[model samples]
Target: MRRLRPVRGKERRKKPIHDGCFEIRNPARLLVVAPRVPCPVKSEHISDAVASVIGPDFTIAFQPIVDLELREVFAHEALVRGLHGEGAYEVLGKVQAHHRFAFHEACRVKSIEMASMLGMRSRLSLNVAPNDIAGPAECFHTAIRTAERVGFPVDRLMFELTEGEPVADLPALAATFRSFQRFGFTSAIDDFGAAYAGFELLAAFQPDVVKLDVSFVRDIHLSAVRFTIVKGFVAICDELRIQVIAEGVEAPEEVDVLRRLGVRLFQGFLFARPGTAVLPEVAWDAA
Candidate 1:
């Protein structure tokens, strides 16, 4: 994983694009593809072994990325998919109806397990609901321990707080985060733009990093409103000296604009697509 650092103005690099897809293995030790949208697949023989709890309905698939610089799989963000003809928003409701928090937690653990099997261990950025931060420390202890057992760097893993829910108690949240810090694990508040910006959390919690939501970067050059918002974000980060990352940068123009605004760190298709399909996407892009 590359630490965020200041960059002198230079040409933005845009080279790769990612078509996202993932294979999911259920707890039952069965393999299934988390379809982009809900689609009917032949399940005749499959029903004999175990009935489907999570049918072929729309569920999210997670894409794991390998950081080329470290030659390791740093983290995997959970991406949602819709049901047969259902949009992500609809599927989200279904997931919540089930065990949304538990599902993501399991997915992160599973993804990390897969990464570790492949000897990829830079960090794991697990997307999670904001409210679930209320869980007991035991909730995350297993993940930390698992990473350790697998020889993964505990400090390098990033637990992404992806929820937009307001931080009800900043001190309490910080206390929870401190536990991770004590164990040498770092944290990041992901999707900062779409969610309500938690300046208090950002300032007080002092997370290791903050991920600028991709929405803020999409076609940013054309959107004055987004540019102002990003500029303001960059300004605040500058003051706090906190690291900020621009996500979903797909065009050279976007990179150029962000560079001019003093945004040093960025991630998107313009740089490399997700998946271990090809390693060192970032390193090769720069070199």
Candidate 2:
């Protein structure tokens, strides 16, 4: 794992491209927030405020990513939920702008802690924001320390760059990926072909994995255009030595079409719904 370096006095004032507030969206819904400056409060003060707001109200659910060829779970994605099992949107909706940074940090720490407690042996995939990596290194250190404390191997961890917003600094993001790679951590672009995480992102930096957006995998067998586009994407990823994982595959026909397109890793309802604090079992027969 990469060692976390302390920020020097000169380093504290340097500004990055993602210094302002940004919105993050998902396929299900769009979360719109006004653009704001970085939180001006002291780190410890904001941390206390965030802890009070987030508290122990959030928990993680594991959704398995299955490998068709191996007929086993390739990884388990950790999804955030409320302590009482409310959806991610409900849990995250309460987070104020100033609390976003600490909220993200808490999610990382909690996810790793829960996954470790669940005795998860498969690679654990966690959602991450580009800004999180591009910003301070504290979040990364917190995750690394939590993993080490819980005895989870850092190499088995994968960070999925969520395609919730446009990346303001591609070069910085790419550099962050390279740095993580040097530490035995894998990088992936989530929701590929969606929003800004398209061909441009691939050209800038080829992640270890590319998860095709749910749009591409939805009823693909019924649409030749979708198939062709997906085929082209698969071919491109193949040439780049990047593994492609088809997301939101809910039908057998979709699986067949994706398999023919060379997508071996899969994640969606066709396999299993996310298990609360446990690794969900895959439904092989469904595929």
Candidate 3:
């Protein structure tokens, strides 16, 4: 495996967040100025100053998304970690409200740059907030530019819609999905059956993939209700031509239940944990 390059400047000064465009000072030079106005979905925005502060403080981690039927890795989801190997919660706690947009953008750029450096050939799935997709033009440009700069193929990228915040406009969000699809990038509704990513979201837009939340996967073999629910999801997704990925799976029993339920993709501890700067090896026999 190739070693990741060290982040430059161990100690850096923090810059105040700004509403308008500002200059970013980081090693990758991937961030650009923010728009003069705030994002339509949210009042706060991510400026260049925020990018400068958050960019270097974080690094990318890769967690394998296994394909059981194919018996190979389908994708490596890019998770954010601290520059010095801190947990995501610890690193994300430092981000203030104003830093949301810039932090999100920084994660995307960093993920692509690191994935390229690591010579990742599988799809790179990125977690995206509803607000980010609500205003897809800016985010799209940044992703396209970063992919070009790092020589990563655009078609291999996947955007997983996170449900941290509820999407107020389904029509607009659906339109955004179409915009991304036009560019050859696939989309996924993450944490299905939980939060705002329920059946309503599925009706609004049929993403290329749907990740069944841990709640649905946990103890599925023991609980008849869970089994029936997951089976229903798999059946529906199959009809819609949407791939189902059972995430947060941790037991062989769970895998047996999921496979019987027609789930071909799996992610969680049973496979491998997220490698801080490396791709963790998958335990193929576990499945």
Candidate 4:
């Protein structure tokens, strides 16, 4: 099984929000910029030689996870962006197998630093690989310290595990999640329906949230088959007591169908594109 990779990246070149503190429409999610554009390259120690091997310069862009019934921002998923605003794969592609550990650590701490600097009050979600975090406490030393340094509570952070990486050892992965939970950090399974992550892992690990893949949510209103599948999936999650967040929701009709099927949480370009400095302004058509 290929190791699951880390993701969630973007950037903005804008003014600081009101003297280094800015408020989004949802006060819970704040985006603070310095007097000039703050550099996202907080991990200067990673070294240019090592970084050249890993790929281009790195930064972060945040995309909002929204709650429709409450009509407020629920959380921000931090994505990795290259200096030229390349996507996660572009940044990640440069990393070789041996450097993954360092790359993952760099991205995690960088996300925390930027989020904390921006005063993100909502839950901040960072992508992590099961392979990289099988021993959570030992692996999380940098993250924990960075959180404390930035005054961001561990509980306010959520680690996202994309299903793209299949787990080689279920028990070990579950233990890792347990370790993280013990430390007050939350967890979620990203791109849940897009891959082979299914009942076996769900029964074993039981993440706090399952992000429904965009394939399921895209044009859902147009497909009765999709509607039925997602509808049933929602029921299963309700019974299991796991929260479901629909991802890649781009149309108003998609939101309507998802709401009818009982998915309250959502993320997609319809609300806002991932932004570098501030939370993208949500149009609030669903509200």
RMSD per candidate (Å) reads 11.6, 11.8, 12.0, 9.5
Tell me how candidate 2 scores on lDDT.
0.71
N/CA/C clash count, model 3: 0
Q: What is the TM-score of each candidate against the true structure?
A: 0.65, 0.81, 0.81, 0.82
Model 4 C-alpha lDDT versus the unseen true structure: 0.72
| Poorest lDDT segment (10 consecutive residues) of candidate 3 | 29-38
Query: How high a TM-score does candidate 1 get?
Result: 0.65
Model 4 sits at a Cα RMSD from the real structure of: 9.5
88-170: candidate 1 lDDT, tens digit per residue: 46665655435665554544554455445444433456665656676436446556556556565444456777755676766
How many clashing pairs per prediction, in order? 2, 0, 0, 9
Error of 4 at 220 (Å): 0.7
Q: Which one is best on TM-score?
A: 4
Residue 40, model 1: lDDT of 27
Query: On a 0 to 1 TM-score scale, where does candidate 2 land against the true structure?
Result: 0.81
Superposition error at 69 for model 1 (Å) = 11
